[model samples]
Target: MDENGKIDTRTAKGQATRDRLLAEALRLFAIKGFEAVGTRELAAAAGTNIASIAFHFGGKEGLYGEVVRHVAATLASLYQNAFAAAQAESRAKGEEPIRRAHRVIAKLIAALAASNRSRWMSLLLQREFITPTACFDTLYEEAIRPCLEEFSQLVEATAGLAAESLDNRVLAYSLFTMASAFSRNGNFLRFTGKTGYAPQDIDAIGRAVAGFIDKGLRPSA
Candidate 1:
């Protein structure tokens, strides 16, 4: 509200500018931690002036907080629908739990491949876990937890473990770590060797990733 007690509204252009700043901030922050980056750098990268950050996000620190929320929400929106469809297909077909798990993992891997295709948001997400901030808990709760529950459910079904058990959570985290590794360091991985994994090769990469996860979870008997 302004002095007149009227509600404030952001114009379309204003919102676009704010979003652009967030995008650039996320990219730079992913490559270089927040403390290392300055407001001037952000303005230069975002094509806006330093005052704009304070105007839109309150300040540099505030922008960082908003960036976390934006990225977390983005991941959820990007994957939740895809996940739901995979789950529905699995249930309708009465697929074996392991097969269903394979499908889920494959889809997840395919998504991961393209996650960093157009933006740094995906890498930015991975960076959070490496050096957590105040927003980590919110990210975990609003985005990570739901996704983890789904993966853990599949793992539990495949492994005959109870829900949310220590074993299940550990397995889930392990799977997550493996799944997110490629996107987090896709360029570095490519530099090391092609490894026959390319984000553009969605089906091939999905099969490879899903197969790896499935085999890793196979029963001893």
Candidate 2:
């Protein structure tokens, strides 16, 4: 606290510095994992010195918590916004819940798969899954759990699955994994010798996913 009552790091400049550190930390952590990343590298990447992390976040671990929050907020904006937007559009049109759910699925595919940062955040999420960290539970509750609840409800509405059941949970997870494959396998595009698709292409992919989902949701062949 520099002998004062507090460090007074709440100034605009300090906040900006803290933000930079969090951003660089997420980028590095996403690639290297938490244990492999060093505070010095984080400082360098953020164009700040090491002490700034201590002043703002208390240390690397604290900084990582902040980064986790940032990642959660980012996903909320990009992924949840897509789902919400599609559902709103579908409802406003007087579409059935099944159709609205289809829109949700297609929008999630495009948002998570095509958006640039989502690809990185997916990598970060994998790191979290591979080994639980201090931020694991918080991140799940703040970001993932809510996402699952929203998804499960959509699935139940679309497929007539019992709510809050194991079946609905499993169904939601499977669908999430399939759509996430877009980002997880994005690098495979180079194999196809084709350019990357845009986020807007969700509409086209929606048609395909909706048709596929409808087939499964149907009563009989």
lDDT of 1 by residue, 1-221 (tens): 56897756756678778988998888888778889899999988989999999999999999999988888888776657556877788889988778777787677666766644323666777777778889888778877788888888878888877776998889888877666665665574577676655546667767887888788776668
Best model per TM-score: 1
Number of the top-ranking candidate, with lDDT as the measure: 1
Query: Model 1 — which ten-residue stretch has the worst lDDT?
Result: 113-122
Which regions of candidate 1 deviate over 4 angstroms?
Answer: 1-10, 115-119, 186-188, 195-200
Q: State TM-scores per candidate.
A: 0.85, 0.82
Question: Pairing residues by index, what is the TM-score of model 1?
Answer: 0.85
Superposing every Cα of model 2 onto the true structure, what RMSD results? 3.9
Candidate 2, residues 33-144: lDDT per residue as tens digits?
Answer: 8899998999999999999989999998898888888888787666678778978898799987777667777777766676456777877876787798988887788777
* Alpha-carbon runs more than 4 Å astray in model 2: 1-10, 113-115, 198-207
Would you list the C-alpha lDDT of every candidate in the order shown?
0.77, 0.76
